[model samples]
Target: MQSIRDRLEIILSRLANRADEKVYTKLYSEAARAAADAADARQKAGVGLGLLDGAIVSIKDLFDVAGEPTAAGSLMLASAAPASRDAAVVRRLRQAGAVILGKTNMTEFAFTAIGDNLHYGTPGNAVDASLIPGGSSSGAAVAVAEGSSAISIGSDTGGSVRIPASLNGVVGFKPTARRVPLAGAFPLSMTLDSIGPLARSVTECALADAVMAGEDSAFLQPIALAGLRVGIPRGVLFDETQAEVASAFEGSIRKLEQSGARVADLAVDDLIAEMRAATKRGTIASMEGAEVHEDWLAAGASVPVDPHVSGPLSRALAIPASVYIRTIRRRTELAASMDERLASVDVLALPTTPMVAPSIAAMTGDEALRDKTEGLLLRNTQAANQFDLCAISLPMPGMILPAGLMLVARRGHDRHLLGIAAAVETLLGR
Candidate 1:
């Protein structure tokens, strides 16, 4: 095997060759070199950290690295005070001996689904420059896809990690919201935000997740496909889905059935509708996000924030506290309903996004289209967050532009979901 230092150097060389300043907000060249060297020395001495030792990992910009201000993909926080300590997850990653590659770009405040960042140039889709990388985890996905980092950590509130992972053709795993501690990360929604890892394969994601969650990095044992029960929620999730994406999803289902997995329609439209109704004033994300940025929202135009992020957030300020409280209570009840509903099925499957990545130009040029596209992109994946479940998005087989086949399981069933994803990935020959 190549030495850790050797691998890190190659990645550093690649970063040096490209104008990747927008993709990676910072590059810990000297620090990474030192970490790599330490790992190599430990290997020579027959002592090493756990599974993630020597792994090249990149964290989302929202994570606080000691002594640096967490910008979170906006100019507003660029001048904020430096963090006194590393984010919780960052500290955990370092403890596992993972070499930090530095911070990747994200959507402003991690509020938007599409990956456009006017302050830091959007990191184009990994496969096609014209298309979006999908965000708010845009740079995390791009860094993994471009081989700059073996694993990129991202924050997923509503499909931030999965959307970018799908568009960029990689694996992204979002554990239950509370599984990994959230301290030191710039907040979008305290209730909804989850920190997850995006990587080239499900196993890699599992390893990173285990390390960050402070669990033992046990090797994932792929669940046998033959008796696995898979649920396909076939209602609103399919609406306005591009032909290619829909076709790919069907093909994956058929493949799974042929492999002896049982597939059946699971109606979740009503449950989702009720959840949406409860949050009609605004999503839990928007309401909580607005509260987090109340000072900035009050500053209005003086703040010079992304309007896409600030608009809905500002509107959410009008949402009465009674409504916010009601929405939270209703969401809790609905989440219980969803969990009970999911008990009959081993996992719920769907397209990570209703459609594949649209061109960055088209998304940026048309406001209405962008809004519509954002809804479509977040539709299928957001349910996992709202319902307090674990989910993984695996790149589908044989797509010119990438799409994802997402599998969601009950809350705290993260390990099971990763095992199932590994099984599906194997079946799909990924």
Candidate 2:
């Protein structure tokens, strides 16, 4: 069998041109080499290696590393001081023996769902160069899909990780909020922000989540599909999706039934509408982001913000403080309602992105297309954030490009969600 390092080197060579868009700001060749050396030494010494030993992992630019600047995809922070120490999650990954491959690009300050960074060129979708890779975890998904890294860490506030995974044909897993630590990482929305992984398979994502969240990896056992009750939201979620997405989702539902899983259609329209209304004023992300960047804004340093990222972020900051406060309270109510409604189901299913990836030209030039793309990207995934649910996006088979099937479970049930996702992946034969 080929060693992990050899596999990584091959992938890097194949996907190097994809990096022309600056999806990765730096490459950690030295760290990767060092990891390979250690793995070889452990093998020779007859010592047991960790699950991710010698595996190459990519980091989103938003996370701090001892010597690198956490640019968060903005020229505004180009001159920012280097981090004195690794972020908490970085340290954890290092301890698990995973190599730090490099920092991947992202939407500036993680402000938008559509990945188009003006400062650092936008990361193109792996499936189609003309389409977007989705944000703010754009490059993280690209790194995994293009095979530059086995897995990549990404922060998801409102679908950042899952959106790109859906667009790029990879697996993105977002644990329940607060399951993973947020310290030493750039803040988007403290209330909804979560650190997770993007990888090629559901199993790989689950392994990364286990290490990052300090959970037991043994919990990811094979699960039976029979009797697994899955809820399908009947209202806006189904109505709002495009024809292609609707057809693909229906086909997936049929496959689950063939595998002997029980599927039921449930209505959560009121909760979905309430959540959308809550976001109109401002989300926890917008409120927290304004506070985090207040110093930069006050010092007149926000001028160089990436236009693609800044437009949405500026609008978020413009929300009234009273509205922001009301949104937070409403979020709590929404989470409670979701918990009660989904108590009996093992998981809830939806289309990860209501529409497939749009052309990069259309996204950047047309405001209407951009808005539609962003809304579609977040429509299904945002509910997970609002309800503090654990969710994962797995690529749906038989799609022209990459489209995703999102699986959501109750908050704090990360382990259970992973098992169900594993079974679903088996049913899809991917």
lDDT of each: 0.91, 0.84
Residue 330 local lDDT, model 1: 95
Itemize residue pairs with steric clashes in candidate 2. Answer: none
- For each candidate, give its TM-score against the true structure: 0.98, 0.95
For residue 375, model 2's alpha carbon misses the true position, in angstroms, by 1.1
Count clashing residue pairs per candidate: 0, 0
Give one digit per residue, the lDDT tens place, for model 1 in 129-161: 889999999999999998999999999999999
User: Which residue runs does candidate 2 get wrong by more than 4 Å?
Assistant: 11-21, 315-320
Clashing pairs in 1: none
What TM-score does candidate 1 get on C-alpha atoms?
Answer: 0.98
